[model samples]
Target: MYVAVKGGETAIARSWDLLAAARRGDESVPELTLAQIRQQMRLAVARVMQEGSLYDEELAALALKQAAGDSMEAIFLLRAFRTTLPRFASSLPLDTAAMRVRRRVSGTFKDVPGGQILGPTADYTQRLLDFSLAEPSVPAQPARAAAPLPDALPCVLEVLDREGLIEADLPPAGDPDPVDLTREPLMFPAGRPARLQNLARGDEGWLLGLAYSTQRGYAESHPFAGEIRMGEVSVFVCPEELGFEIDIGEITLTECQMINQFGGSKRAPPQFTRGYGLSFGEAERKAMAMALVDRSLRAEELGEAAHAPAQQAEFALCHSDNVEASGFVQHLKLPHYVDFQAELSLIRALRAQNPQEPTHD
Candidate 1:
């Protein structure tokens, strides 16, 4: 019973009807198909996959439709569905170096191992609204090269890595398994892997704000975009019985590697530290934001100061999940009649104790 309201079920059913009506808009207008959302509204689908911790484009698109395009609601729906799925064996480490390059760019150097490919980017385009797109028109298609690109293109960071200018990514001793954050609660004093996992599944707007803070000098930050690569990488999973890896399929990914200056200490030499971010699709902004935040959170491990909220692992990871945050914040909408009444009585008593002054009239 919602606050002892009568016929709550009827109200709820009516509410659902209203939601559906609104979602459909005009009945004459064609309803958006799942394929349309998956292909046309790709970024929305990507965000739902990233934050929901699920990688199914179809499901993400469905969730978006069910939620009527409310991203937070869509994420909640996707996660709810994901909870019912059975887990298979963990996949092998993704070989990003072997990714089929679609878009690759680096800010650190003029040229990288493979020449920068500005593939299907709107970054250089004017921000003016194109009224022409409002009408149905034939879309333009890009020309393909005579020859196919190499199967494997060297990572842009390799240029810096060769000279030992950037820090090496040495695996921790014993090579422990990374934390499955979805299964385990994020405890305080979380490790790099845990932080990375949280950030990967974190809310984009929240991460973006924190990442922007680092750039604005909220933390000791002079980060450079070493590379941003968007491509399709093969996913391999090894079955315990098979005893060998099998390529399941390919998924589009956007990877960002940020290089930041770090002063040398007694135990280490001066070199550029790395901040890494990976997204499920061509989510360049999200990937870049994740990398910046990843670096800031490494402040303690790198023997630097944690002067910002993003640097604090507990704060960062706890609030990263928009689902949880939204729940807590939105719960206020629920009936709180008793609590409100109690507060009302107390406030009345307090006001009675401190009577108002006599009016001049």
Candidate 2:
């Protein structure tokens, strides 16, 4: 009979104390403020919020600070904290058509309806390092056009839809609302909604790699970035007390619409299909990667070959979570002394049986 013991309590406590001390750094140096992290490390915060599946910028910044800039740890921290919060009524579905546009572009078309509005992006900037950034100076304010982009920019996909060139993007009439992913494990043969949600929360690097695999001919898909846009959208929720929905607040969002190769039957003429991706902030790369993976995953529905890894639902959704992946991988650092000792004893027995066996550890 074996009994478990509560070992390493004092050492664990001391280790954490040491960690706290290390996090603070030299006492002479001023500690970092949460506000500074929130403002300055906006991209980092956005990644945490997006991957963590939480929308609070402040909380995401706090998690980042606590994790010492490790994105995986920060996402885990935010997710752990988010589990404690109570859920109220769910918000009404967002109207992307009414989104307040900040940045908008299309690779498929040279000039979209509202003209390509390149608002607050570093896409065209030269890659050379700016040494001046080390010594901070107030940067000059960017010039603004007299009339900014229109309140709601038309979607490029919608333009294709008008000419009956793109497949219709609508849900089945009798389909139920999407099941909350947190409450239930993702079932195989997942609906589009759940698949999209999983991709949205999936690891960005993993998705990027898989997306690249598709472009490299791992899967058959010729993708065109129909449009990519980032901006604010209003959220509305209707509480039990209030019969009508009330405006909550605005949240920054990035959306990507990818156009893929024609998927038409003998009855229908050749037309384009779509892949969609959306994130909490200006995570364009993530959005684009997600779009590619999403299109790849739809191979089965389109009656195309599903031989690629990206097209497999189990392969994508099960391993996409960075927090879970890191936890399982890093847990090897913890004590495995007992198991190792058992293996060692078995090895010793085998060595005793064959004295001529060379000594090995």
User: Per-prediction count of colliding residue pairs?
Assistant: 0, 0
Q: Write the per-residue lDDT of candidate 2 for residues 159-275, one digit (tens) a residue.
A: 889999988888779979998897898998897889999999889999999999999998988899999999999999988897999999999999999999875876556899888
The residue ranges of model 1 lying beyond 4 angstroms of the native Cα positions read 1-7, 358-361
Candidate 1, residues 34-113, lDDT tens digits: the string is 99999999999999999999999999999999899999899999988899999877889999989999889999888778
Candidate 2, after superposition: displacement of residue 179 in Å? 1.1
Note the residue pairs that clash in candidate 2.
none
Model 1 / residue 281 / CA error / Å: 0.8
Each prediction's TM-score versus the true structure: 0.95, 0.93
Instruction: Give the deviation of candidate 1 from the true structure as CA RMSD.
Output: 2.5
Q: Please name the candidate that would achieve the greatest TM-score relative to the true structure.
A: 1
Model 2 CA lDDT for position 140: 81
RMSD of each: 2.5, 3.3
